[model samples]
Target: MSEHNTHIEEHRDDEASKLGMWLFIFTELLLFGGLFLVYSIFRLQYPANFHESSLELSVTIGVINTIALLFSSMTIAFAVTAVQKKNNKLALRMIGITLLMALVFLVNKYFEWGHKFEHGLYPGSDLMQLLERGHHLYFSLYFFMTGLHALHIIVGMILLIIVYFKVKNGSIHHEKYVFMENGALYWHLVDLIWIFLFPLLYLIS
Candidate 1:
């Protein structure tokens, strides 16, 4: 009877943890949804400027980053599966691959941003100050939105790193992996946001 009760309690705890994560995910969606709405309005208001500004971005780099995130999403999902299968070695390998993908994305972004800064195209540069209103607003939103997304990437990376260590130490094993699941969920959110961002900021032009 005691063993059964413990099992039930553990199951309830898992459900509660999932529910909490969903609630938090809902709030994040709301935040990003509002930003998306604002972007839509501005894009409609200054279609030509948005197009022109977007043309300044490198579709190649954008596409590369997109692919990296997509692969990372797959690897993280695999990590969760590996844990469930009691394959700790495979689980660790998958997490390592996910982290590597994230690193690739960040390194690409760094070079892209550095190129923009070198040309004085970033926000607050004197060149930006002289741009037309529409152009100015477009770049402002571009920097703000993408910068915000990048911060989330960094946070997601941190969370995955924690999950990695936990898995390595056997805390997140086959029988108990709510933390890994939650980390993957957050990473998925990060990837999903970029999916919307890629087309809106890069391909729309």
Candidate 2:
């Protein structure tokens, strides 16, 4: 009877954990949704300038980052499945791949940002100060939105690392992987946001 009660309590806790994660994700969505609405309003207000500014972005780097995040999403999903299947080694390998892809994405972003910095295209540079109103607004939104997404990427990576170590130590395994599941959900959210960002910030040109 005690063992059965413990099982019931564990299930409840897992359910509660999942619900909490969903709530957090919902809040994140609301935040980004607001940002997206603002972006759309400005994009409509300065269509030509938005297009011109977006042309300055390297589509090659944007596509590469997109692919990296997509691949990472796949690997993380695989990791979750591996854990559920009780294949700890496979789970670890998948998580490693996911982390590597995330690193690739961030590294590419670093170089891309550096390139913009070299050209004095960032938010506070004299070049930006001299730009037209539309151009200035475009760059501002570009930096703010992508920078915010990059922050989320770092947070997602931290969550994945925690999940990795937990899985390694057997704290998150087949029978109890709520943490891993939640981490993957967060990672996917990161990727999804980038999906929206890529076209809006890069391909619109």
Candidate 3:
């Protein structure tokens, strides 16, 4: 029957959408995995150097950024929940809050990075000055890894902005919130990366 054909087509469309999202997520994981592998190899090769370089990082600033990212993740989660409840206003508010938190996180990172640059600790430039003293390799990886992560955070914020508008304009609804959900998932991935990065780059002995 034509009715049965229509139902089947709709189901296929839904399944395809979900599959696409999962594929995107998997690719993101692999991208980050490559960076993690590099970090692990370098850390293993220069444990002492890494530890010493890590000490130069501002623990307080890192902690604050961590808290900001965690709060943003929470806000995004709430936004997703609000959309599920069909409360567009609350969802928009939550997304706005998440965006604010993301901005705060980026600002803190800017200062942290600026402080390092002031000390001539930038990657590939004055890195030799620190490595010459024995253990600046860690700083190299720190900047490379954390710098890449910060870029991802910026990307996540942009995605959130898009999702906010989509939800606000009623393009996303309770029954059709796949885009918003996927966007939240991506944002959470960014936060999760920072969670691991904080400990690896700043907390490890």
Q: Which tens-of-lDDT digit does each residue in 73-137 have in candidate 2?
A: 99999999999899999999999999999999889989999988999888899999999988999
TM-score of model number 2: 0.94
lDDT for each residue of candidate 1 in 1-205, tens digit (9 for 90 to 100): 5655654443448888988998999998888899999989988998999899999999999999999999999999999999999998999999999999999999999999999899988989999999988899888888888888889899999999999999999999988999999999999999999999999999987
CA RMSD of all predictions: 2.7, 2.5, 3.4
The global C-alpha lDDT for each of the candidates, from Candidate 1 onward, is 0.92, 0.92, 0.84
Clashes by residue pair, model 2: none
lDDT string, candidate 3, 97-128, tens digits: 99999899989989998987887768766555
Sorted on TM-score, best first, the list reads: 2, 1, 3
Residue pairs with colliding backbones in model 1 are: none
- Model 2 residue 17 CA deviation (Å) reads 0.9
- 2 or 3, which is superior by TM-score? 2
RMSD of 1: 2.7
